[model samples]
Target: MKTAGGSDAAKRRAGERAAEDVADGFVVGLGTGSTTAYAIRALGRAVDDGLEIRGVPTSFQSRQLALEVGIELTDLDAVDGLDLAIDGADQVVDDADAAAHGALIKGGGAAHAREKLVDAAADRFVVVADPSKLTTRLERSVPVAVLPDAHTVVADRIRDLGGEPTLRDAGEKDGPVVTDNGNLVLDCAFGSIDDPDELATRLSAIPGVVEHGLFVGMADATYVGTDDGVETRHY
Candidate 1:
């Protein structure tokens, strides 16, 4: 059985290996999550060692982490585009041989909207994670960012699509969990996503849905860390 500590170590190794893809003079999109935190730290060390690069963080948490690590930071508005983006996925849907043809479920941290924007702007989006995150099918409840006023309607729409939607409650607060963009989250449980592309399309067609956790065909490559070592797959 895999322990949490061992998985975390793998996450760190995956992050570090992904950070090696960063180069001098590149404008990078820093991702949000524990696994990506390792990448941020590794990038910081590279910066200190004379690698000239700038980072656009995906969330406040990532921004603060980057600042503490001495990484030079920039806003998305300040850059025309990103050379690379490194992120972590809550669930990855791809085989070892599959490169770019895959999907992902993210937003465990409520920053999916911002993450999608940064990732889409990047020339290459690299996913870093422990091998434990990979799955033959993405069955995690998909996170949908909805307008506060549209939650009920969106929930109904999700139900129409055969999904059970629940408003995500804040663990530390007394209300629904709000995203960084001041919206609400609906965790739509569909059991197993059979057609990710079609599901993503249907979710996007919802009026109040700002964004969905389904990252369909967005990853350029992924680095998965296992007990033996890190493995890289391109798509």
Candidate 2:
């Protein structure tokens, strides 16, 4: 049986290729995840070669990685806008209406809220992932960041919305896993979402919901790594 090495190699290739898009003097929005970690390394190498670019990292993990690679960093507010954002998604589905566009579900690392904010601030958002991430529709569970005080209330609301919500627990510790923003995550399963936009709207309307992983019509392009090579899709 084939293990995940192929997939991991694919992610590294996709990340390196995505990093090639970063140009000198550009302010890049660094995203989180294993795939984006490769991008960070590539970007760091470019920085060593004197690529005068600055990075705005979306997560603490990303920030540390960028620093280790010697990528110059700055705050999001310090920059007018990001030239590009290279990130990864848990799932990518083609838009039902427009085949060119993709609807993404992210936050597998529980950093979707910050990822969305940074991605939205960029002039171009690029998602890099292995081909395994592509799907006909988003069937994976959606991750919703909720205020700690409203975790139970939000889970109840999600249940009423036809989802099975589970409060994400920490792997090492006993209590729940808290986010950088001091929020908790609810992994809500709604099966294969036929209409993600509609569901996203409904989830957003719920009080105490900070942000969800349903990224509707946000991807400018996606770089998918396959057994053959990297495939590029533009939206």
Candidate 3:
């Protein structure tokens, strides 16, 4: 079989990891992204293969995929602690693919708030990715999740930080891009970030902000798949 390549590659790797993890059967947290879509498909396969796990999709799109794949569904408000969360990062470390000490910018699919919510509820968060998504540093690709109604104002704040902030297109040509929570995503180009933890904290303090794309101290480990093989990193 051909390995996943290009933009679709990361999802393929992430899906494999999710497949392995989901087999044990526990409450699982799903993410949104091309890489994450792979996990969704894998979850469907797992269910088809007799895996028993309930899923809390981070976005409506993910929810639909989960249902299509036959993963059991549960309401976010009804769930307590989750067994594990298999997610995908926009970037990982080139060497170790570790999520720790690495800056993560997600919510490009506008699932930031829900993703963070599920991650926080999980005892373990494992981020799956391909090597190209890995980086020496984090925050270069800061994906900011914002309320669709207050986007322009929040973007202005990003500009105040001396960076160019662009409203993230939800890969659609019609209608405002809707997040699972009905928000918009702002892809901010802040260049190299020196303090990601601080930025995550500051962004969350903003009103009308359900959540930001920063995952600090949330991920416990990461599994990075490369052309050579898979590299595991524990936080």
> What TM-score do all the candidates reach, one by one?
0.95, 0.95, 0.86
RMSD versus native structure for model 1: 2.0
Candidate 1 lDDT over 50-74, as tens digits, reads 9999999999999999999999899
lDDT scores for all predictions? 0.91, 0.90, 0.73
Backbone collisions counted per model: 3, 0, 2
| Candidate 3 residue-wise lDDT at 229 | 53
Model 2 misplaced stretches (Cα beyond 4 Å)? 1-6, 94-101
Question: CA shift at 57, candidate 1, in angstroms?
Answer: 0.6
| Ten contiguous residues minimizing lDDT sum, candidate 2 | 1-10
Relative to the true structure, candidate 3 reaches a TM of 0.86
lDDT for each residue of candidate 3 in 69-150, tens digit (9 for 90 to 100): 8889997788777888878777654435443464566665667788888888988888877676666767565777677778
Position 197, candidate 2: lDDT: 93
